[model samples]
Target: MKAAHAAWRGLEPVHGMIYFVPEARRRYAELGLSGRAGYFTSRSAAFGRASVELVVSTFYNFNPDLVRRALDGAWDVTTPQHVLDARYAAADEALRRAGLHELPALDEVVALTRRAAESACEHAQGRALFAAHAALPWPQEPVLRLWHAQTLLREFRGDGHVACLLSEGVGGLEALILHAATGEVPVDFLKASRAWPEVEWADAQQRLRERGLLDGDSLSADGVALRRHIEDRTDRLALPAYAALGDAGCERLAELASAFGRAVVRAGLLKPG
Candidate 1:
């Protein structure tokens, strides 16, 4: 479990840097996408002009209105292939800027992560986002391939996490509120980013309090226990993907990926939280 968490922590920045880098925004701007449209469109483009409801269902935790605003008529302006190409191009430029290409043992990290991602593909029965990405052709370049591999793994884990949330009867906004209660992310940040109304946020908080999972803005003992259970279940669901690496391989991947992820953070490619 520790290895799984560590590996994800290391790889998260590797895959997540694309969203925060200027290169991604520039590419999206070239296609006339502004504000948060690039983010919503680029991530969901694999679904080929996906519906608002579909994005809401798969993204799980964003306000549906926000999803609709970003996705509506986005495909009319750009094709999914073009969006995917731009996304890959942004990742390529971002990685190059981070100097990940010059890192030691780059091939080994790529190979290990790719092996795990492929293994994840085999268990994609309930992983919509991962399965969508798995159907795409592999990138030929090592750096981009590394990004794609981590992207797959991230989405694989994300889909499983969504399932855990659903199984626990936690809705999209409730999940954000719970996460905020954990003190890892600010409630304001989650609320603003997800475009949830203040009233809805308050209502969700009240609901959580009624259920004994929250006390005011913080988690009660029951809340802490439930959050732990959700995360533990999510980790267990994500384990099959990393099982291909074995414990030793996972630890090695974690070590290598942590160095690379740190380099990316040092390069200022990732946004400050």
Candidate 2:
């Protein structure tokens, strides 16, 4: 932000036009840290040396001692040190198996230990996890949809490339054309472009045609203009019924709506685009 503000100093002639860009919001959403009242405190900006070091320190300070005291014996500061060391030695061996030659630092080992303990606790309590995302929050579906839209909007802002935006959010071919509008028109977007099934191909094509989204099989020129216009005019949030909001303090609504839209998508609750 400081660098951006500095760069915009001389452009103050257009500084009035220096509104908050939409892409800024997507990054926060991807990290599960966008909303006002939600986020993990211990990990958020809880710095040590390197980020990996923080995890180790957190394990050494909290979970390691807790585990040893609760199961093995009474714990002093050094009580869990052996467990931490042994755990990391196993990890170092595992990494070695995967062709990663270097050993973990003491801090990294401790951090890895902490993560394993934390994950075990979560697992014991019955929680779903995706590989390493043991602590990712699942916002409401509507909230996730809004966040997903924000992510798309963010990707659309730079060089107008729309692949990531479309690939991540689009459920079918119609949304694909809409995504293509955010950038150069893609020539073969709808023709087996994504991992589409042969079964869904004819139906998707027919739907695109019936919805007036394509010229025969390709997106029409008006479709292109509409995409660009939509990208520039409204956020990809595609928020439902903000009309009730009227124009009364719309700015705050847009900001919240952007965040909410992102949450909706992140929650895997989005309606078809």
lDDT (Cα, 0-100) at 49 in candidate 2: 16
Report the Cα RMSD per candidate. Answer: 1.2, 20.7
Top candidate on lDDT is 1
- TM-score of every candidate: 0.98, 0.25
lDDT of 1 by residue, 1-273 (tens): 788779888879989988889999999989988888999999988988778888889989999999898877788888889989999999999999999999988999999999999999999998898899899999999999999999999999999999999999999999999999999987777887899999999999999999999988999999999999998999999999899999999989888878888989998997832
Predicted candidate 2 versus true structure: per-residue lDDT over 1-273, tens digit per residue: 222212112112111110122222233233332332011121222121123333333222122222222222112212223322332233233223322232122233222223323323332221111112223332233222222222222212221223323443433344554554344545344332233444555575566667566566556776555555545433322111122223442333333232322332343332211
Candidate 1 TM-score over all chains jointly: 0.98
lDDT (Cα, 0-100) at 219 in candidate 2: 64
Candidate 2, residue 244: the lDDT equals 24
* Candidate 1 global CA lDDT score: 0.91
Candidate 2 lDDT for residue 97: 33
